[model samples]
Target: MVANGHHWDPKYPEYEGKFTGKFLHSHDFKGVTNEWKGKDILVIGAGNSACDVAVESARVANSVKLSMRSPQWFFPKFLFGMPSDVFAAKTPNWIPSIIKQFALS
Candidate 1:
């Protein structure tokens, strides 16, 4: 990630019209203009990415609104039915790195 001139724009371009991972579902209008700092922010998506942006933007913005065009297939972020961040936190640090290497291999 490259944060140049107040924007953290990725230096890389998309690969063959595909994205490799989850990301914040947001608009560039607010980020480039800084008009979204204190206004009611509305995100128009329902994937996990959208969920993350909604949560993060609410922290700095006055309010948030999520506008979904269609229903998304939602899965609870969990481990054995409980939210997974807790377990992920407890996960051995080497495990994720190893898993990532294996996936790329």
Candidate 2:
């Protein structure tokens, strides 16, 4: 079966033969924390899904290893009564960060 992300990381192939633990998709995690829930999890990737999974998993898991090829950012799902994903992008760039940050606080 095809993987979740659009592009498969080539290095991940090595983990198929190396990693000896459960491999789960964040999309399927419906709050059913698994047996490995209490242990540290190495979440591979920095995309939205990876970040989301890491945050959720961190609640139950001791720690999370957010492996990222490069940096990533995630605005909140809601801000000012709108989805931050769209709002952050639409907000005028001229607005100072402190003002927005204060409003959010």
Q: lDDT tens digits, residues 2-105, model 2?
A: 12364433232244356566776654555535665688788777766676777777787877787766776656678878987777788788999998776655
Q: What is the TM-score of candidate 1?
A: 0.39
Best by lDDT: 2
**Candidate 1 structure quality by residue, lDDT tens digits, 12-91:** 22337764533332433234235446766656556555566667677777887776656665544766555666755666
C-alpha RMSD (angstroms) for model 1: 12.6
Indicate which candidate wins on TM-score.
Answer: 2
- Model 1: runs farther than 4 Å from truth? 1-35, 72-82, 85-105
Error of 2 at 67 (Å): 0.3
TM-score of each: 0.39, 0.56
Give the alpha-carbon lDDT of every model. 0.52, 0.65
